[model samples]
Target: MIQITNLHKSYKTGSNSLHVLKGINFSVKEGELVSIMGSSGSGKSTLLNILGMLDEADTGSYVLDGVTIKNLNEKQAARYRNKFLGFIFQSFNLISYKSALDNVALPLYYQGMARGERMDRAMAYLEKVGLADWSGHLPNQLSGGQKQRVAIARALASDPKVLLADEPTGALDTKTSYEVMDLIQQINDEGRTILVVTHENDIAHMTKRIVNLKDGLIIEDTPVQQVRALENV
Candidate 1:
């Protein structure tokens, strides 16, 4: 669950300031799949970064699963991030030399988990993502969709409370994107709160709710009939 109110953020460029988010307010409940939709420069990325605790808001309040998020030291922020959030990026962020299994296991490795337990958890998630058979394959060895699946597995391996995906299917073909979205929908059905930041209409429609952002503010936030990606595929 997430609650944000009156969020405001800006960046300074020499003598001018670029305002990224303005008076943003929203809440996402548990078991909900939501998409933040916006064009480039609409502040969706800024909002996602703030939500992921990768960046700080200039002003406002953010509450994640009952914990207030504000003014924390780097160490404290990192601890909360590891304990509560997981991320999936469009770029697939995997190490070129690491096998799929090793890539999935990296987060657990950061948590100081032992090799045996880490491998066990990693394999379980890889299997969950239907990538168990490809565990030994490296990123370059896999296709775009396959790499994204591996990224999804890696994000879930840590068992975080919320999954944050930014342009999750941006780099894939339409068919592959549908497949990836189907997996995301299935994961949401199992009751994990998922927030996707995307500009594609079809991608946003796959989610239960869509929050449309324009010029750094939410213009529309509404629930809609969930679009099944498999049907579209």
Candidate 2:
């Protein structure tokens, strides 16, 4: 589970102070799929980055799975992030030259797992995301949907407790978007908590909960009925 309170983050541009996050307070329970919806400049991505431990907030507190990130040093933050968080991006951040299997195995490699074990785990996750047949294919050889699936597999490769995805379906067509969303839902059903930031309402509806952000504050938080996972197809 993750808890954040009075979380404030700001940036300095020349002589102006840009307040991106203003006292964000929210909690994400274990195994819950939560969607964060916001418009441009709503600070959703900033909040996600802070939650992902890639950016530090200037004030307030963030407790992820019981550890306070406000006090962690750079190395400590890196270690904790590697251990507890997985990320999916709209761009499908994959190494163009690496095969899908190798792309998934990259995280495990960073975790220092043995090559054999890492390869095994990567292959398993690839199958889980319906990319087993494309394991040997390069990113360019795959379709947009396949690339996103590989990204999802890479995110799951680390076996993190939480998966944070940003605009996951932004680059794909409607059908492919639905497919990617379905795959993410399946992962959530398997008990991995997911917090996704998306501008698409339909995509947000797939999640069990919705949190809306505006002007750096949480304007609305509501829980919807649990929808059928991977049944949207």
Candidate 3:
């Protein structure tokens, strides 16, 4: 579960400050699948950074899974991020030289997991994402969707409390995007909290809830019938 109240953030440009998030209040419950929809300069990225702990809000409170997130040193912040959040980026963010299996195991290695245990866990996640057979393939060797699947497996290998995906389906074709979304939905069904940041309307619709942002404000937050991606694909 996550909660942020009256969040405000700003950045300086020369002498002027551009406010990114203003008096925003939002929360995502455990096991919920939510999407944040916004245009360029809509502050969705700022919000995501704050939520992902990549950047802290200038003011307000963020609590993740019962831990208050504020004023932490980089070391502390990194620890919390590694322990509680998994990230899937649009570009997949895989190392070009690392094989899919090693890519998935990277986080666990950072966490100081033993080699044998981490590899086992990584392989399990690869299988979970239907990429077991491609475990030895490098990112360059896989197709766009398969690369994304490898990213998803990497995210899950940490077994974090929440998955924060930024434009998860943005890089793939419609069919591939739906396939990835289907995997995400299945993950949510198993009780992992997920928050997707996307600009596509159809992508937002795939989630159970949509939070619309504009000019650094949450203009709309609504729950709707979930669009089953597997059915559509």
Candidate 4:
């Protein structure tokens, strides 16, 4: 579903150029759940941004769901991203004043979905995330895990082909983290491609495959079981 080759990205810092991604290469098949594990300043978020089409790569190729994204214009990129990707972030990125349902419905509204249809879809996803009863609660009223569930519902409400999550369980307690991870696993089981970026090894292990990154390059990419087995050797 997603193919990237020799991807490179850099930022200009006055007279010096800071390289954020150095020829990264990987492919994520449709319905596969992949985790990217990296330390701070390791370019995981930069990679996620590129994958989400929020930022363009400086060089190399990226074909997402059969569409090449390197040269897409802003409007074209936005259209592809809106139609093909959903995002969950650690910060819960919800509007403070909006209720859970309203937050979930926002993306559909951006896509010009009819109000009735969007609300229905939002409510359905909220129910899937076990937040249906809390639809009227605003962000501030919900606990961290609850807010994260609302974010997950919001992500799914778009019905996108790929889910890109950045540190999704970072802010929650262990139990809540596991609960959220279980929801992510369930979502992946339903045939959606999930790529999560996290610094936590345990969280990364929850996914089928983990890609370890350091100094802007993938150092190891393996199934989670293999990683654990090797660690125990």
Candidate 5:
């Protein structure tokens, strides 16, 4: 459902140009669960940002679910993101002042969903993530795993075409990380497309396919024997 070709990205630092992604190419089909693995300077984040439409490539093409993604005005990009993309970050990215339910409902609010319906939809997603009982709790009131569950609920509330999770389990303990990954696998089992950006080898193995990045290029791409996270959980 996503395609990129010969992608290139560079950033200017003082007088030097730092190339983050060079000649990157990959495609993700619908219903696929993939991981992009890389180190700190490996350009995985840059690739995810381009896919997430949070940033643009300096060159090459990107097409998402049949729509060409280039030169989009801020309004257009935001509309596309709300309509077709869901994001999960390692930091949870929840508003501290908002309750778990409100945080999940935020995207629908931006879509102009009515108060009652958006809330109902958000609650359903929270239920899916096994956090319905904690809907009234604020972020600080929840444990790290609970907060990530809330974040996952918020991501799913939009029913977007693809879920882009950046270091989804980075901040969790081993057991909690596996639990979160188990939840992700369950989502993928239901045929949702997902791309996880992570550097952890164990985390990457949980995905159906792993794409390794080094020095801004895809150095390896292979399908692995999927390590079921549920087994660990």
Candidate 6:
């Protein structure tokens, strides 16, 4: 569902330029769960940002679900991003005052969905994530895993084509992390295209494929035997 070729990205720092991604190439098919693995300064976040259309590449080609992604105006990019992409961040990005239900309903609000319909959709996703009973709870009221589950529900409420997760499970204890990963694996098994950006080996192993990045380039891309997080949990 994603294709990239000769992707290059750089940032100017004073008089010097820091190259972030160099000659990156890869493709993710529909229904695949992939992880981008790298250490600090390895360009994984840069690649994920480009893939999510949150940032533009200096040069290269990116096609998402048959649409070429390049040179779009801000309005056009936002429209496409809303229609095709969903994101989960490590920070949970929820408004402090918003309840879990309200948080999940926020994206549908941006889509111009009416309150009644949006609430119904958001509740359905919250139910799917096993958080229906906690709908009235705020982020601070929930545990880290519960907050991440709310975030996952929010990400899915829009029904986007691909899910882009950055450091999912990074902040939780081992058991909670495994529980979150189990949910993610279940989502992928149901045919959602997911790309997780993470540095943890166990986290990467939970995905079907791992793309290792080093010094702004992909050093290794390979499929591996999947590790079921449920077993670990």
lDDT (CA) per prediction: 0.96, 0.91, 0.94, 0.90, 0.95, 0.94
lDDT tens readout by residue for model 3, 78-191: 999999999999999999999999999999999999999999999999999998999999899999999999999999999999999999999999999999999999999999
Model 4 agreement with the true structure over 1-233: per-residue lDDT tens digits: 99989999999999999999999999999999999988888889899999999999999999998988878899998889889999999999999999999999999999999999999999999999999999999999999999999999998888899999999988998778888888888888788899999888877887899999899999999976522212322
TM-score for each candidate, following the candidate numbering: 0.99, 0.96, 0.99, 0.94, 0.99, 0.99
Worst 10 residues of 3 by lDDT: 224-233
Given candidate 5, what's the lDDT at residue 157?
92
What lDDT tens digits, residue by residue, belong to model 2 across residues 89-112?
A: 999999999999999999999899
Q: Which stretches of candidate 6 lie over 4 Å from their true place?
A: none
Q: Which residue pairs in candidate 2 have backbone atoms (N, alpha carbon, C) closer than 3 angstroms, thus clashing? A: none
Over 1-233, each residue of candidate 6 has an lDDT whose tens digit, in order, gives 99999999999999999999999999999999999999999999889889888899999999999999999888988899889999999998999999999999999999999999999999999999999999999999999999999999999999999999999888888999899999999999999999999878998999999999999999999998999998987
Looking at model 4, residue 127 earns an lDDT score of: 94
Report the error of model 6 at residue 84, Å: 0.7
Candidate 3 vs candidate 4, lDDT winner: 3
Residue runs of model 1 more than 4 Å from their true location after superposition: none
Clashes of each: 0, 0, 0, 0, 0, 0
lDDT of 1: 0.96
lDDT of 5 by residue, 95-195 (tens): 99999999999999999999999999999999999999999999999999999999999999989999999999999999999999999999999999999
Model 2, residue 161: distance off in Å is 0.8
Task: State the local distance difference test value for candidate 3.
Answer: 0.94
lDDT (C-alpha) at residue 77 in model 1: 89
